[model samples]
Target: MIFSSQHLLFSSLLLTGTIMSISSTSWFMAWMGLELNLMSFVPLITSKTNQYPSEAALKYFLVQALGSALIILSAPLMMDMDIFSPMLLMALLLKLGAAPFHSWFPSIMEGLNWPQCILLMTIQKIAPIFLISHLVTQTSIPEFVTFSSILSALVGSLGGLNQTSLRKILAFSSINHLSWMLIAMLLSDYSWLIYFFFYSIISASIVIFFNLQQYFFFSQLFSNPLTSFTKSFMSSFALLSLGGLPPFSGFIPKWIIIEAMAYNHMFLPLLVLIFSALITLYYYLRIAVLSLLLMTTKTKLLSPFPAQFFASYLTPSFLFFNMFGLLVPSFFLFF
Candidate 1:
């Protein structure tokens, strides 16, 4: 229900590409669809007027281009082509900003506003996951996925340790999430898809709200009135979900994945993941502390735009997906 023509176009293209990438057996066709999705997003990123938008656009383009090149370079290799598949997996990991290759992610998110970052963090994850699923069985990339994800977890936790930028912290969190996603991708393909959908839903809502309030996002809106206490409360709840605490949508998929991995005897990686999650929790709490440091002052705020009937309807729909992630694990398959 997004209204702008350009917004609709990119969304359509993303949908089309996602479907095409997942359904097709031929890797080439899937890659082409990914290309289509990437080209489609350039306009969306550049359509905004802010300086951060331009920087985000450039960073996104360069990173995508590099990953695209890697995939294309490996096109000639056979399915079981030892390191070739690893190379391709690495490309997807890089594209997704998974560990070791994750430096670009924070910079990119830092430049974009909240709404745009929400789009990047959510919808953009689908394509690479699709590609990873397709290549997983045919290659020896599971080890890589496990290792990379561990790195991602470590980076996600440690990278944002002192970051003051709100979006950058989220970006690192996104990188950390990728590790879990890639690990999940090793088990059930459906797991990855469902995890993505629900996480995206909750995240988009929270980011949009953050942007609307213009409260300490991307080094701006520093004059927030939401006291540190309230921020800590919301941030804690958000981080708990992010940390995959039970009862929150974020934890269910992670719980399932950890079970799946343990069932397969991936003890070391699972332990690594758990440790990294602890690390991630630290930074998230750090942010919470910052958020909690709000002034004990209140001021009258301006009347913001009234939620259109459509937005009112849409908001709950999006939010429900987040809740759905927590509540009904099998809900997506019904759709």
Candidate 2:
């Protein structure tokens, strides 16, 4: 009972901070809201009594702290300048898990169990990205943001290539998604919102799907594979969908963003972006293929599900978001 209440309170505070960040006009107020969001989430990261929890909590806290400090220090400059602060904006990128400053993402993801990672990867991302988009008009963020977007996509795709840990692969995938998100950031304000909504759903769905499986490590994919064809096919679809292959909701945002990029005539940038997509697809396909080696004598067939903290939160919730994104694309045409 105590644990339940604590969880409620923490979540409430974090959410309150997120909304406040969105609504705030004062740079200071937005900064405070970010701090509030960060502090609230720290407890969640450390809530579990495990080594990974403690380490993840520390990494998350330190990265956030550094990012927050940069924003706060730059606050005074922007106040007098009328122009949006580039440093503060860059700091926001770090906080949002964009590249160059993205080293923390995979490590932190490595430390958390999947549920926490899911939340961190999805809903938790909403606040910072929201604040960043809000501040875009105050500065010449388009070019700088564009560069970061490409970097994030390149790094994410390359980083995941030979990864053997499930968490690390998802971590890299999250980074790749951030690259697309940064592009959305440059295109339109609504684009960011649309990207966030869909991205969160897709990420949460993928994480939930992964959480249901037996293996935790990436190399373990072939070690013990799913014997049930239903489970195997569903999991494969989820990964493929994550790759933004057609028919699934995952492809919806990619289609929109690519179209949006083309409309903007960002030809060279688009070329770079497509290449990164290919790199990401390569790694994702590798995992899917390995998981299929379930029947081979070289690897063990899977066993029963182990009780995990994130498993419950992932289900139904994931199913809802996964399907929701598929339908939400209709609204974009009018925009």
Candidate 3:
């Protein structure tokens, strides 16, 4: 009971910090909010009594602290020259865990439990990315932003192919998505927010499913005791949606972005983005295919009814969101 209460308190503080940072009028207030969020989250990173959490918390602190310091230092320079813009941008990029600065991300994720991972991937990103969106408006978005974003997408696509650890795969996937979010930030305010929101929801649904099953590895996804055709189908469907396949909700954001890029005649970047999406799709399909193969047993089993029920309920939640933009195109139209 005490543990539960601690979680509730810290989680509330986490949300409060995120809201404060995004809504802040000044960089100092945003930094303060981010610090509040970082301090609150470090404690929660260790729900299990383990060394991994301690190590992860330490690494998280160092990176966030450095980023915070850079942001602070950049403020004083805001008056004299635009040189500090790159420093400020780099700091936020580090916080976002984009490639080249992303080394800390997968390692920290490896040490965390699913709930902590969810917060790390979803909520933790809100402030820094929103801050980036704001900063770019003050200075011309750097050419390096586009170059690094491309590198991030390619690195994320290629890095995850050999990873068996689900956390690491998701980490790489997050990096890839960060590339899209960065590009979207260049395009429009609504684009990045839409991408981030959909990314957060889709990621949470998938991670929560894994959390319920206590899966930590790709192989374990196929090793579920309650394996069924429906479960396998939904799992694969969710992954495909995540891979941004057409007709699914995940495809909506990608579709919009691609169209926008084409309109701007960004053909080369568009090609690279498409290539990365295809590579990512290969792995998502690999997981789904492997899981489906395990469901071929002729003998019917019903021992894990609770797991089955959870999967059934969760799958539709994912499907609804995946199909949301398709059913209501106006949602994307407005954005």
Candidate 4:
């Protein structure tokens, strides 16, 4: 938890597990890698001092174990029987926390610290999603994934509408983004990867900002009078970027995916995705507007502390990227 030796060991194993799963040539090896990944993550999430983490660890273990069991069970049968492909797909979707199977995600996120939450949202998803991409090429899997994507978009957008906890909001946001990535996966091999790369950067930046401020809820953003105008503005901008607002880098990948979807004539899913995106942007705007528009009398220009200093310096780079990063793709395209 403190980046000590034990943490280092487990973290290394965690990465090893993901690499193994993604790179493995056989189902058995992949399953073993997933198990190793699961085992390594449990220790990282568990803590003696905190009860919530322990409870979270248990829930995470159980859910992941069930998914792993399904994977192992279905993997052997997949070659001989077509039905097993859906079973295997379901297992991966469960692991990815794609909706309908996503009930466990928000609760687990609530119990994690920001660092662990970042891992859960980003790195932990890589292997399962890669496996899903592989599986999508099989018969009947696309329809299933399509339905799950639509459901994930709807559930993720609707579920976050009333949440106050920052973690829960992020959890739902991850789910919504997963819907987009799922659609991207069906469209092309690399579109989801592109979307995920941008998503990870934006999500990590937002969470890191929250971690720096020790903010766990919306109320804290408003209550902390020492919050600076620069910090507030950056935070709002990051949230908007995450919500996929135009002119921000976050919207770039979504725009690419939208273009591809249009070319494919997938109008219905496109409409649903766009509408759900609007809902997601609404909540993000809610947070950003309240934090940016409401004036605080005791706002500080800068805080004389090491943490604030680090954050203050780091924020400008992120702000610059969010503001101008949309130009990057075009720069490559035209020139």
Best by TM-score: 4
- Count of backbone collisions in candidate 4: 0
Q: Which portions of model 2 show Cα errors greater than 4 Å?
A: 1-3, 82-84, 225-227, 293-335
TM-score of each: 0.82, 0.86, 0.91, 0.94
| Deviation of model 2 at 139, angstroms | 3.9
TM-score of 4: 0.94
> Which ranking of candidates, highest TM-score first?
4, 3, 2, 1
Taking the tens digit of each residue's C-alpha lDDT, what string does model 1 give over 1-335? 24788789887987788778767778788778778878887777774557777878988998899998888887657554556887788788787788888888888888776777877898787778778877778646776777888888888878877887778778887887888888888889877776786577667756865765575453443355433433334445665666666677787878888889899888888898888777777766555555544422343124333345245554455445445545575666799
Q: What is the lDDT of residue 54 in candidate 1?
A: 85
Relative to the true structure, candidate 4 has a C-alpha RMSD (angstroms) of 2.6
| Model 3 lDDT per residue over 106-175, tens place | 9999999898899999999999988888876665554667877898899889989999999999999999
Candidate 1: which stretches are off by over 4 Å?
79-83, 218-223, 226-236, 289-335
In model 3, pairs of residues that clash are 249-322
Worst 10 residues of 4 by lDDT: 296-305
lDDT score of residue 26 within candidate 1: 82
User: How far off is residue 334 in model 3, in Å?
Assistant: 21
For candidate 1, the C-alpha RMSD (Å) to the true structure equals: 5.2
Question: In candidate 2, residue 213 scores what lDDT?
Answer: 68
List lDDT for all candidates, in order.
0.72, 0.77, 0.84, 0.91
